[model samples]
Target: MNETLPMTGKMNIAANDDWWRGAVIYQIYPRSFRDTNGDGIGDLRGIVKGLDYIADLGVDGIWISPFFTSPMKDFGYDVADYCGIDPSFGTFEDFDAIIAKAHDLGLKVIIDQVYSHTSDEHAWFHESRQDRTNPKADWYVWADPKPDGSPPSNWQSVFGGSAWQWDGPRRQYYLHNFLASQPDLNVHNREVQDALLDVARFWLDRGVDGFRLDALNFSMHDPQLRDNPPSGVPMERVTRPFDMQDKVYNQSHADIPAFLERIRATIDGYSGRFTVAEVGGPDPLAEMKAFTEDGKRLDSAYNFDFLYAPELTANRVRSSLSNWDGTPGEGWPSWAFSNHDAPRAITRWAQDGDVDRMARLSMLLLLSLRGNPIIYQGEELGLPQGHVAFEDLQDPEAIANWPHTLGRDGARTPMPWEANAPQAGFSNANRTWLKLDEAHKERAIDRQRSDPGSMVSYTRELLALRNSLPALVDGASRLLDTPEEIVAFVRTSDQGDVLCAFNLGEQAIDWAPPEEFASARMVADQDTVNGGNAIRDRIEARSGYWAK
Candidate 1:
C-alpha cells in the first residue's frame, strides 16, 4: 500500500462530539494486521506504521481489536489486564506512538474493551477464585453447585458444554460464557462496575478516542441462576449445546442497560468520546435498541444481522435495514458485513458469482446505508476467508466443533500486503500464528493499489463519495418498492437526496425507478447504471448505482 497520505478529502476530526454518528470505522485485528518485529504477530508499532494506509482509505476512524495483556486464550478477547498492554503487542510507549501517529493522520482511534469476561489469569479473577474471601471475591460470577454436584443451571458456554467451571480453590462453580479460562465478570456488582469504569478512564486518559465494547450484552447475567429455555426454533445441525438454548438467563440481563448508562456517563466526561456495543443473542434488535436507546447508554450498537447471514438477497437486506427505522428515541445503528469473528462477506454472499463485481457492489451498498459502516481490515481488498486446516487451527471454538464449522481462524488470518513478499509482507518470520490465505495473495494491497479497477480503489472512491454526500451520512432512509432481486432505498437530507439501488441477483433484469428519480443523474455505478449517465431501465446482474 502507499505510504504517502492523501492531501485532499480527509476526514475532519474537529471537536465534533457526533463525529461517529455516520462515520466509517476500519477494524484492525492487531495480531493479523502487520508484524514489525519479525515475531509473526502484529503489534502497536505495526498499526502506527499502517495509519497512513488506513487514513488514505477515507475512513474517519479505526477500531483496533484488543491488544491488552492476555494469555492468547481468545486472542486478546480474554483480557488479563485491562490497563496493561501485552508484551507481544509492545509497551505503553508503543501504544502512545500509535495514538500520536493515527491522530496526526486525522484518524480517530477506537479500541476494543472486553468488559464481558476476562482471562482466568487476570488479577481480579485470580483473587475472586481464591477462596472467595479476597477483596475482589465477588468480582466474577460464582455459584454453589446443586446438591447432586451438578452445575448451578443449564446455561451453556458459547464454546461448548456447561457455562460453569468447577473452581477447586473457591469450591464453587464460576461462570464462563466462553472458554473455561475466560470467566464472566459480575457486572451486577456495583464495585465491579466502578472498577470497569475506572479502566475506561485509564484508556481515555491515554488520549484514545473511543471504545468498541466487546460482547456488551454478555456483560451481565441473571443472579437467580435460572435455566435458559430452549430456542423453540429448530436447527438442522447443533454443533454445541449453546446453539440449542435461547441464551436468556445466561446473558442479556435487564440490568445491562443500567451499567451502560454508567458507562455512557463516564465516557461523556471526555469530549468527543464514542461508544458502540456488540450485541448478539436470541433477540438482538431489542437488546441493541435498549442498550443505545435515547443515546443515554451508548452512541451506537451493531448486531450480527449481516455478519452471519448465509446469503445477501434483496429481501434479506431490506428486512434487516427496515428494523432500524429512524423512529423517535430509537438508538443509532452501526452495520458490518464482515469482521474478525465472521467469515468474509464476499465469501458468504458472493455465492460463486463474479467476486470482484460483487465486492464493489457490497462496498457501494455498505457506504450508502444510513448507519455507520465498519470495514474489516482486509474487506477493502476483497480478501476471502483464509484456509485453515484442522491441524493449523488456533481458535478453540472452531477446534471444539471441528467439521461442523469453519471457525473464526479463517477470518483472523494475516492481512496480505504484498503479492510476492515473504509471508505476503505481513512479517519477516518463517511462519505466522495463522497461515496467509494463498488466494488472498492475488488481491494483496500492492496489486490493488496500482489497479484503478481494484477493490481498494473502488472502496476509496466509494468512501470519498460517501464523505461528500451528506445524504449518505446521517440522513433519513426509506426503502423503496422494487423488484424482488433489486434492493432500493433513498436517503434524504437537507443537503440533497441520494437514490441507491442494487441488483443482487445473478441475472440482469429490466426495472424502472420511481418517477421522482426519472431524471436523477448517476453519481456512482458498478456496471448497473452507467457512470455520469441518466438512470436506465435495465439493471445488470450483481451491480449497483448511487444517484442524486
Candidate 2:
C-alpha cells in the first residue's frame, strides 16, 4: 500500500495514505469565487488567485467546480470537451499551473468531472444526431417518438419542460434528465463508460489528486423509459423542478455503480488520487451507499441529508447521521452543509441575529461526525444567503419557481472576499452576472479572517483540533441515550474516547457532560450554541455543541 511520491519520481498513489478519509475539503465555485479577467465571469485564473485564501482555511484539498470546455448553457456541466478547459474558465495551461501551485503549497487538488451528460455542441453528439447510422449514434440515448409524435415516455426535464428534445436531422428525440442542452450520456453503453474513463485518466495524468463526480446517479437510465411516479401535490426538490416527482424513472439507475466500479478501477490505477460522487435523487442515501460500498466504487459520496433540512437541530442532525450507521464495510460518507447548488444553512436555519452561532455549530457538528467534510466557500465566514432580484437571476430552476422560493441563485452568489471592497471584492466588472448580495459583504472572509470569534476562525480551530485527534478522523460512532431533539454520540478510536452532544430545539435544555466515561475531559467545543439556544449542553434555542 506504499505509494510512490509523485513529487519525487514518476507517479502512482499510495492507498494507505488515502488522504480523502475524514479530510476537510473546501469547495470552490470557480465562477463566483473570483474573477481574474474583467469579463464579468470567474475563471481558472481567478481560482488560482483565490488559492491563497483557500489554503489559509487549513483545508486538506479543494473541490473546484467544473471548468471543462462547454457551450455553458448549463454552465460547464454541458461539457463539449471533457479533457479541455473552457475558454470562459481559462485554457488547459491555466488549469495545469493551478494544479502545480496547489501541490507545491502542500494541498491536494480535486476537480469536478461531469460524466452524466454533455453539451449538444459536443462533436460526438453533433455527429450522432446527423444520422442514425453514425458510429456515435448509439453513444447517446436517442429514441423514436411514441405514437402521435409525443416523447417516448413521460419523463420531464429538470429545467422545466419535456426531457426529450427534437433533433430534426435524425428525426428522433434525445433524453436529457436536466436541461435540454445537457444531454445525459448512455453510461449503459460500455463504449460511453470507456470514453468517460479516458477523460478521468487524462486528468489523473495531468496530476489531479481526485475528482468530484457531478450527478453520478443520473449517468445510467431505464431502457424502458417509464414515466416517473408523482410525489403527490407537485413539490420542489429543494429549488429544482425535477423534485416534483419521485424521480424513479429518470435517475438512481440500478446499473450506475456497475459503471462507477469501472471509474473506481481507473482511479485505482493512479495510486493516491481520490474520488467522491455528488449523488441526488430519491433514496440518495441508499444510492450513496451503493456507490461507495465495499470499496468497489467511489471513496465517498454526498447527498442532501443536511443541505435541505429546514433547521439545524440536534435531533435532525442525529437522525441524518444515524441513517448511515453501518459496520466497517459500509460505504464512507462525505458531509456538506452548504454548496453552490444549495441554499446556505445560515439562511435555511437562522433566528434573530444568531446565524453566526448556527454557522459555528454546524461546522463543529460536521467536523465531529464520522465522514469527510466539504466546507463550502464563505461558509467558513458564516455568510448568510444573499438576495438576487428576478432581473439578476441566472439559475433556470430559480426563475421557474420565483416568488414561492427565493431560488438557488440567492445562495450561489459571488463569494465576499473583502468587506470594504466594491462588490465585496469579488470583481470590478461594471455588471457582474448576478448583483452583489448586500448582507454577504459584511461577512466577507477578509473581514473575519483574523477574528478568533469569527466562524472562519472557528472552522480553522476545529479542523486543526480534529487533525490532532485520531478519534475524530477515523473513529466509530455510537449514539448516546438522549432525547429525540438532542443529538449526542461517542466517537472512539485507538487515541482515546470522544463524545459529542447537540441541542436542536427551540427552547434551552440543560445537559451534563458524562462524568463516568473513563477519563473524559472537556477537550474543546464543550458548549455549542446557535441563536441563543444551546446546541450542546444547555441545548440553546436552535443550537448544538461538541465535547469529549
Error of 2 at 249 (Å): 2.1
For residues 1-548, what per-residue lDDT tens digits would candidate 1 score against the true structure? 33343423344433477888888999999999999999999988899888888888889999999999999999999999999999999999999998898887778899999999999999998788887678999999999999999999999999999999999999999999999999999999999989999999999999999999999888889889999999765677677889899888889889989899999999989999889899887569899989989989998999998898888899888988899889999988999999999888887887875667767778888888888899999989988778999999999988998888868999999999999999999999999999888888988898998887888887877777777778887889999988899999999989889999888888998988889988899989873323678888899888889988
Report clash pairs, candidate 1. none
The candidate that wins on lDDT is 1
Q: Candidate 1 has what TM-score?
A: 0.97
Which residue window of length 10 is worst by lDDT in model 1?
A: 1-10
Q: What TM-score goes with each of the models?
A: 0.97, 0.92
Query: In candidate 2, residue 138 scores what lDDT?
Result: 90
Lowest lDDT 10-residue stretch of candidate 2: 4-13
